[model samples]
Target: MSRPRCERCLRAQDHCLCPLIPHLQSRTRVVVLQHPSERLHALNTARLATLGLVNAELRVGEVFADLDQLLATPGYRPVLLFPGEQAQALVGYAQEGCELPFMLIVPDGTWRKARKLLYLNPLLGELPRVTLGQVLPSRYRLRKAPEAGALSTLEAVVQGLNVLEAPGCFDQLLRPFEALIEGQIRAMGRETFERNHGGR
Candidate 1:
């Protein structure tokens, strides 16, 4: 039988990561659009992000209803954090568009699933878009990246917040992410995880 899951963190009881997360607040709100399939995936990271950030929320759906409401919310500019040639560099936006804080709308799923979200919800396609820049290598050892620039949901949030919210946001957010990775590594054993994650 499967181990009992923690009601809060939603992981196995022993692997509960809720207590490790730091409470981070920012003027900018984070909205994660997660596909239903990824809601319970063992390695999903978006849920953990919402746990720590005061202004963050996770919405599970194939097509969203509040695309209009969220974008229209006063005092916040909703922008999609999907990378593309048309996606303005996030740093450029944070610097130039200093008039208002951002509401980062991120899609959490496989590349195909994320694309499906954009297709299903045409309103999302109309939002201003932003992309991360000069990122270090991804530390998501649990899954193979679909492409070179891809990042886990939590990592993307950290990167975006660090650029748009404040400095050190990356380090604060990274604590929980690194803790989760280390816990999984310990569970899998160093030798097996190293072999699987490209170490000798």
Candidate 2:
């Protein structure tokens, strides 16, 4: 039989993270485009971010049909949170054309899958790209990051919002994410975690 789960957090009922999740409001609108395969993963931090932020929305799919309308949000400039040669650093990014808040579009998936999302949806590639100025070490100890600056979707969103709004404004969003990481560590046992992850 399947274990019972929390409807909101989707975690096993006994280990629900709902209590740690905080409801935060941000000036920047966050839209997370998640790959469908990751929708049910145990470490789906993108879902946690969506649940914690009032202005955030999560869409699971490869090719988004409604992306046109979604990006048409008024009074906010749309920018993709992705890294590339031309990606502008978001730290102190000057509002050249208009003084509008940013609508941050984040793609949630592995690097290959995220790239596929862009290939399937050409509009995503056309958007202005922004990268975090500082690449902090990830708190997700369960999985090794694919690259040096790679971060979990939740961490990326939190850092992005901090850049757009005030520094540390969205730090609360990490409460549940950190809780989840700790829970995973406990479940795997301290010895195994330390052996595999170097306890870093």
Candidate 3:
């Protein structure tokens, strides 16, 4: 039989993450487009990010029918948090003297799946793309990063917000993510984690 779960954080009731989740607010809005494949993953950090941030939302899908309406949200400039040759550093937005806040649209999935999100949503590809200046190392100990400086969805969102807002402004957002990671490491046995990932 399956174990009981927390209605909110979805962890097993005994291992609930609800207590660590914060209800913090940010000037920049965060919208995470998560692929369905990641919805039930043991370490779905995207969900934690949305739950912690007051001005965030999580949408699960391969293709969104109302993406146009979603992107058209007023008073905030929509920007894709993806890297590319044309992508500008997010820090530059402030220097450019743009007064509007940003609606950070982040794709939450594997590299290929995230790219699929962009391919499937042509409108997302048209947005101004922004990249972080200097990315910190990922704290997602359970999974290997696809490339250098890659981060989990929650980490990416926190870094993006830190760049857009003030440094350390979104640090509290990582509490649950960290707790979840620690919990996983414990569940896996420290010997196992140390044996598998300690050298990295």
Candidate 4:
């Protein structure tokens, strides 16, 4: 028989992280533009990130017809978190003390799919783009990143929130993410995981 699953976290009941994860609200709002295909990905952390925030929203689409309305939420400045040559690092801006509350738009998908979210949605492209400054190595040991400094969606959001708000945001926000990775490693066998992720 198939294991029971938690409809909310989408994790099997044995691995459900909901009870252990606490809800956190921030001054900034999270808006995830998730690819439809990533909805069921085992390692997807976008949902975890969204669940942590009180003023967060998750919208799935290749091109959002109502993106303009979403972006135009009064009293919040929409900022797209995408790194590239054209994007500005957020650390200095935070230090400079920009006063507007940000509506953070994060695209959840593969590199190619994330880029498509930017291109297909004209509104996303026009938003102010920001990136993390010198991210530490990702803690997602289960899946190798395509390149160095590539963080899971949850990591990026946590770091971004840290920049915009204060340090230590990562601690509360990463609890669920860390739990998911640990559960996966336990399922894979602790000895095998330790041999690879820890010194033998």
Candidate 5:
């Protein structure tokens, strides 16, 4: 049999829906530290996040080797987006008078890889960790997470921007993810409305 079609965007073999990706500009930048394993996966949300946000950057590697170089980038604050009681909640930075340029760093991979990234990267360990307080469900249907509220890369970016009170940017960055997922769902003859949510 031929290769299986994408359940979300029913493109034929080699004609994936990822090419139609869109990006949005925001005051805050999004940096996706993706695992090499997720680079080609159809269900990887880092691709979706990069497609959705113009300012988003995707780095595929096991560790952030150039951590200092990334930190030296002009006009950008870096915050790791992860959920944990021990993590430094993001509410502190949401206030005014904070730095103008900042990056929301998200590790894209399985829980094990994500934990490894966090543990191995000394620079990342130095930065403040942010967690989402809202208890909701994930939108990534193809993948499974241990936690019910685990969000995809796209959803995490949207929520992070919203926490920064940048709705326009959030909506802008979210559109392409929405479109791509919807396109895929429609291509598979699935209900578009059902998969409109951010997490599966």
Candidate 6:
């Protein structure tokens, strides 16, 4: 029997959910700094962020070597997303009332690699860090992390936007993600059903 194709986008050639794309507008731009390794994975949620938000940008790199240049582009305020006792929280930027739009810099990788990226990039160290406080549970089942509250890229973006009271701006992006997961589950169930009933 031939391998079943992914049902979400119906791309036997590739897992492309391009048809289910959602376009959203936001006052806050999301900049996802995906680790080079995670870019190609079919399940990477950063891609969801890129597809969901009109203002979202996804840049894959091993480190933040060019982060300053990236941030210097027009209409972007880059903020590092990291949690630490010594780190100044996300609230600092809000209190300052900086007029520029904020860009949430999320490190997409294992905890260790994320830490390495933080340390290797001097520009990242200089930027104000924002740590989310809601502590929501993660929805990503395929990847495991030590922190139960650690969220996928899409979830983090949602939470961040909601915190800024711009939920409607990126709310559409959530639909495609839900559809993708649902499609995958339904496909698996169909395969199971067919296998069990095929000989009957």
Q: Which candidate comes out best when scored by lDDT? A: 3
Clashes of each: 0, 0, 0, 0, 13, 0
- Report per-prediction Cα RMSD to one decimal: 1.9, 1.6, 1.4, 2.0, 5.1, 6.1
| Candidate 2 stretches greater than 4 Å from native | 92-98
- lDDT string, candidate 5, 1-200, tens digits: 77877554344446565555564677788889988888776566677677666677888888778888987688877777886767754543446568665688898888888888888787887777778767356555545567777777778777777767543445555555565566567676565445653234
Write candidate 4's Cα lDDT for 21-109 as tens digits: 66887888899999989988997689888877887878877989988888889979898999877898877335768777889999999
Task: Compare candidates 4 and 6 on lDDT and give the better one.
Answer: 4
How many steric clashes does model 4 contain? Answer: 0
Residue-by-residue lDDT tens digits, candidate 2, 1-200: 99999999889999899998898887788999999999889988999999999988999999899899999988788999999989998864343334688899999999999999999999999999999988778998888888898899999998888776755488888998888889889999999999999997
> Which ranges in model 1 have alpha carbons more than 4 Å from their true place?
92-94
TM-score head-to-head 1 vs 2, winner: 2
Each prediction's TM-score versus the true structure: 0.91, 0.95, 0.95, 0.91, 0.75, 0.75
Model 5 worst lDDT window (10 residues): 191-200
lDDT of 1 by residue, 55-139 (tens): 9899999988877887798988889999777898777345666778888899999889999999999988988888887775788
* Residue-by-residue lDDT tens digits, candidate 3, 78-139: 99999999998888446657888999999999989999999998999999999898999999
Q: What's the candidate order when arranged by decreasing lDDT?
A: 3, 2, 4, 1, 5, 6
**What would the per-residue lDDT of candidate 6 be over residues 38-123, giving only the tens digit for each residue?**
76565667877776777878877876566778878787777778777665444433555777767777777767777777777777
lDDT of 1: 0.83
Model 6 segments beyond 4 Å from truth?
Answer: 1-15, 87-98, 141-145, 167-169, 187-200
Better of 5 and 6 by lDDT: 5
RMSD in Å for candidate 6, one decimal?
6.1
Query: Clashing pairs in model 3?
Result: none
